[model samples]
Target: MDSMIKTGIIELEEMEFYAYHGCFREENVVGNRFLVNISIRTDMTRPMQTDNINDALNYVQVYNLVRTEMQQTSNLLEHVTARVMDSLCRHFPDIEWLRVKISKMNPPMGGQMRNVSVTLER
Candidate 1:
């Protein structure tokens, strides 16, 4: 029931940033590592044929966009994920589909957990 839908994936994985994005007071004071994984499917045939950077989807631009979203603090992972997806969709109408996972590494949840993540698709 769950799998990657497209082979033509433009992926950026484990892009890490330290940010304050939790409801707790400590979370705001002590930022945590957030890893962003982005996947996009779109028409890349033209870019492949032309060999022009202009013709291709720019990863740097996408990364910057994600960074801008990540820098802003939010109390909920859902809100952060929504912002990322909304921003991407607004900018890239050509993208047929997109999926994003934002993970908070080693969160202070008072339990032993590796990470907490939220995934959004559109």
Candidate 2:
């Protein structure tokens, strides 16, 4: 038997923070805005009826993990995105796959906005 469930998109925008994640000295001290988007895939067959939070992946807990990751310092967006994915996978073993994206808005670049992100599956 095959069972799969689609958990709709969960997005967190304009999550401002101060972090030393840039190569430049000035950029490290002056942080920028970070946006995170996470998509979680799991089997909802059991949780659908039981209505037990433990039976399924808790989105609230996922959000908190992202927040906690942002608090840490990473010099690369890829690292940030990977950390988010790893954290989520560890927290919710029921999840079969996860897609995580992290964007750094309004970067130190002189011209247009700076946005970098990565997607990972586990």
Candidate 3:
């Protein structure tokens, strides 16, 4: 006999913030808008059977982790993105996979680009 474990994905998209994360002095001082998207994959077997909050990944805590990291300024989106992933790993051992996207809106790169973003997965 074989048993299969149930898995589920939780996504948080378009979470906006006003953060200072860039190399330019103006960007660091003035701050800019950022959008974060996170997709977390984990086993949901316990949550499914128990129907208890403790058995599932608490999104409020996840959001707090994101907010805490976002508040700290970074020179590169990649660095901040990595920090976010690291935080998730520290908090949630059940996460089997993660995808994180950090977007800086209206980056001052001397161009008409709307945004620049970095996506990381593991």
Every candidate's lDDT: 0.91, 0.72, 0.93
Model 1: per-residue lDDT, tens digit, 7-95? Answer: 37899999999999999999999889999999999887776667799988889989999999999999999999999999998888899
Q: What is the lDDT of candidate 3?
A: 0.93
The lDDT leader among the candidates is: 3
The residue pairs that clash in candidate 1, if any, are none
The residue-by-residue lDDT of candidate 3 on 14-54, one tens digit each, is: 99999999988998999999999999999888888888999
lDDT of 1: 0.91
Model 3 reaches what TM-score against the true structure?
0.93
Instruction: Rank the candidate models, highest TM-score first.
Output: 3, 1, 2
lDDT of 2 by residue, 1-122 (tens): 23454343434444455565666787677877777877776767766767797776677788889889888888888887888888888887877667777777777778886676566666
Candidate 2: C-alpha RMSD after superposition: 3.4
> Candidate 2's C-alpha lDDT?
0.72
> TM-score of model 2 relative to the true fold?
0.79
Error of 2 at 75 (Å): 0.4
TM-score of each: 0.92, 0.79, 0.93
Instruction: Report the C-alpha displacement of residue 63, candidate 1, in angstroms.
Output: 0.3
